[model samples]
Target: MPQPHQADGPAQHAAGRQLPAPRTPSPRDAPPLNWGVIAPGGIAGSFVDALHTHTEQRVVAVGSRDPERARAFADRFGIPAAYGSYAEVLDDQRVDIVYIASPHSAHFAHALQAIEAGRHVLVEKAFTRNAREAERLIEAAGERGVFLMEAMWTRFLPHIDVVRQVLDSGLLGEVRTVAADHGQFMNPDAAHRLFAPELAGGALLDLGVYPVSFASMVLGPFASLTAVGEKAFTGVDGQASIVVTNESGAHGVLNTTLFARTPTTASISGTHARLEIEGDFYAPATVRLISREREVLDSYVPAQREGGLCYEAAEAARCVAAGRLESDLMPLDETLRVMRALDEIRRDLGVAYPGE
Candidate 1:
């Protein structure tokens, strides 16, 4: 497997590079990465779609509580094995990694199970129902000498590398503020998993993690956070506003909601200028750099034909090949920080889940 080349700042675009020379991965390599997915759902399907776009990684097994549903997802993706129980997938000796695609409430148990079974795990965000759960899983993974990662897919996108380069290159100037919001209309039936307390239904955990993670990625962990939000009929936070002040006094305004559609956009302002991310910013989209008199920035488009989720998969494969347990860009520490922020916001709004 050929590792991806390092992507430098926004200046790479000034040279007329059309597509990023990203790492092209193939499971055909000597030490292939075999992936198993648990609780296939909307996002899991997207990850499977993205996995197809890359090489060196394959969804070897699909697992669900319902055998028929597991088989359906496996058939949909041409996966080799379908298991009726998550434990069976974990028991499969060939599975090198297990993706915890279950609802937020189940993340802790599922990820810990995979790690204990000697398989690396990728838990979807919000990594767990709360920071306490995240800590427990992180500690468990560390104790087992296995790998664990939160599937906060945005940080692995080419845009993250691009933006980091732009900021480090001194092209963005001193940081001023970061504003991000990700929300969508959710009219799920009262019984839908997203609208049920047992499933940890809420906008803060599902849609809100993106903006909060984006802000933290740019500004690092905040030193102070003051937030307020509104709950839905089910008492889950459907709307929330978080004001974060970093140690440097740099401020960030992050918002999330499930009741209605927001722009699903994000922006970063600096002492000298600002960067405008394209709508659907979470999916490795584009961003424009704007200054007083000139627009001196290049926005990134999706680099592959399939879903962009493969970027993180590619990173995981690379790290495993290198014998590393964690990723630099999307570290477990960062995952815990963002989850803690969401936890605080949920607490402020008095939105409690089943485990809490």
Candidate 2:
């Protein structure tokens, strides 16, 4: 077994093999930006609430195809303006950035519109329907000179920062494998978004992206992957089990399903140690470092419980304030790479969305 290194470097461990403290800054420290939200959906509501409860940022406007829905969301959140169309939100002079919270199928078009309007954009994840859309958005953002980011909220969480520090510090020796799974039981109704191919509905885009992104974060880039999948009643992918190999020959075992609830846990194993994240690992949760002997060396618990969405918002706000086109933590290149990997998986599984 490989032994953990004792180094005087960026991360300083505690006495007796303790974990490093997370270097994440408070969300409130980020410079404030006026945000306009598109699509008053469930995720949007949570995002707006997190921003209001934790950051100095303000949501100046909200827009939806349905006027009453936009008005209701605005009133609920105390936002100043409610528009009946996404174009109205894009046209608002006060919006420094646009947050596109639309469904997976709509991410590309909505984010493209925001970029064309010269508004910095934060797109909800599974950034686009495929790698092609992701590339176009990145190119458009470059031409427009506006910031663009996929809101992969887990990447910005405090617990994840601790995991990053541990990996960087070599506490886990030669990292060999990463394993993660995310699954949720969804209704079988054909009309539900998860079952509709037109909406890009599937286990992979909606539920699998978490484990795939987590694996990408730990393993860098995918060199090759093999996938086995099953389809839902509506012809959308219902589950997938994928094994990926990175350039360094490290392996990532990932799984996702819409047919059952899973542990949703994740673990990274190395020659000397392993780090395990609690269930619902994509959100704020406990992280524990274990030794080769299976002894717990250290553990970390997050300070906040419910409003974890604010961290990603704060990251976007900071990036825009610093005149950046994308975040260092979740770069556009990585986003495209992940999309390519997802595309490969979909192809292997024979899962195709309607109209590309």
Candidate 3:
């Protein structure tokens, strides 16, 4: 472990320095692409809405298992095509990319379908059921030479860009700890996806991913971790608390649960200063930089809020236009590392999905 820096007057005065500004470009500046939506659920609606509101990208087609659902979604969003099966979305010639907003268990299959159809893919977060599934999708996308990314929207937000700049500038000195938690009180009905084993549902995959990925961004890959969890009535993980250590010995303390509402805040503590984020840290929230003596140095608040998801869409559009196969901001390798960490956490918690 690296030794902590001794507090010096100059170092203490460092907090008075100006913080870096976000360099994220405007969503409207990216090249437009026609997008297809598979599994037109609530998240897909939000994504399409964001794109339509903030970017030039078009949602040309939508697909759902229920024909009515598909048509309804398409009509609601002014989409041109609606199909009864997800395969139709993948097969649509007009779609340059397909967004997979299916449930956890369906991500691998839906993304693979899009890849096989030669469409770029953006799978929503908790990218897949496990690391193995994540690896398979990445390898498939690579073999096909198509763009693939996990819709970790937080990574693309302007505030997050500011966080990235701060970390890279070494303004915080050596980071020693990261702490984040996300919890939501959910209806525990067995049929709801959150409590369903068949759908690979759990608090860890749905709610925990934010904190885990945030820690990964701040502390690099996890080297080792200790996890303990409780099960809901439906035999799925209800809550989990984890302490992860990175290769540099920095620690991440994380927690997630479906039984209660948490502050949903996050923080990074380093030798010289600390960065703190407001509740719903994974979304467009305020970020604060503070000295070790607890003086606020600076803070950041977004100028826009309603369509924050457009940032990720803009990134996807930019990468596709540049012919890049994956985003440097949310690389496939990091997705896999985070998945492996989640897998280990689930393993230690004795949580397993029905169909693997």
Candidate 4:
């Protein structure tokens, strides 16, 4: 049996082993940015809270289709300006970057608008309704020479870096399988955005993206994929199970659902060992590395925070300050690849939104 090693810090293994400590810079370490929010939705609110509480970033303005809503959100977040339309926010020369929190179906248009206006953009996940849209936005951002990134916040968290270190060390010995799931018991009403086709209402876009992205982080882009799902009354997929295989013969099993709440856990198994991420893996959480014989080798638990969104915000700000057009950690190519995988999953499920 392979013996574990101990280390000098909390990252020590049982057998005198030591993994490189995660090098996550503090949010305050990043250069400050003058941010504008494109949509005053729940996510935007959470993002604003995280930035205000943990970083030097400033949310100078917020915009919404509803003027009253914009003002209300601004008040809640202590933002200085509120706009009745997104164009107004973009027009604010004071804003250096825009966080596009609009619905998935609207991401392409909003991101393109920001790029055209010569502003950097950090768009929410499910970057767009489909990969084609993602490709177009990526091309536009590249041509405009502006920074663009998908706000898959989990990718920047400290724990994920630790996972990366573990994988890079070859301690796991050829990861062969990755399994993850995300589910929430959302209201089934057809009018609810979670079930409306016109809104891109589906578990895959909102919830599955977490697992799909998680798998991609571990397994890379899928070489082939197969998916099965159940549709809701509103003609959207309520739940789905997907199996993706990469060129190395590694496999990823992923699931997501709007019909019920699940454990939201994830695990990666390799030839010699495995790593188990605790429930809510995509968020700030814990991880355990175990040997093939089920011996616990090491464990990691990140310091808890009010919210972890600040990490991604800081990364974006740092990249922008460094004059990088895209984050290496969450590149446009990777985002496009993940979107393509999602498109395939949706196609297999026979689910299509309005306007394809």
What's the TM-score of every candidate structure?
Answer: 0.90, 0.97, 0.96, 0.95
Candidates arranged by TM-score, highest first: 2, 3, 4, 1
Candidate 1 lDDT by residue in tens digits, 151-187: 8878777666767666665555577789999888988
Q: List pairs with backbone clashes in candidate 1.
A: 25-55, 26-55, 26-56, 27-55, 27-56
TM-score of 3: 0.96
Tens-place lDDT per residue, model 2, 1-356, is: 23456564544445326877889999999999999999999999999999999999999999999999999999999999999999999999999999999999999999999999999999999999999999999999999999999999999999999999878767788789999999999989998998999999999988899999999999888888999999999888999999998887889999999999999999999987899999999999999999889899989989897999999999999999999999998999999988998999899889899898
Q: Tens-digit lDDT track for model 4 on 1-356?
A: 12223223454433223334678899889999999999898999999999999999999999999999999999998999999999999999999999999988899999999999999999998899999999999999999999999999999998899888777666677888999999999887977878889879899999999999999988887888999999988889999999998888989999999999999999999886888999899998888888888887778888864679999999999999999999988988999999999999999999999985
For residue 189, what is the lDDT in candidate 3? 95
lDDT for residue 25 in candidate 4, whole number 0-100 = 92
Q: lDDT (CA) for every model shown? A: 0.80, 0.93, 0.92, 0.90
lDDT of 1: 0.80
Candidate 1 residues lying further than 4 Å off, grouped into runs, are 1-31, 294-297
lDDT by residue (93-150, candidate 3, tens digit) is 9999999999999999999999999999999999999999999999999999999999
RMSD in order of candidates: 5.0, 2.1, 2.3, 3.3
- Candidate 4 has which clashing residue pairs, if any? 4-15, 5-15, 5-16, 5-17, 6-15, 6-16, 6-17
Residue-pair clashes per candidate, as listed? Answer: 5, 0, 0, 7
lDDT of 4: 0.90
Cα misplacement distance, residue 53 of candidate 2 (Å)? 0.5
Clashes of 1: 5
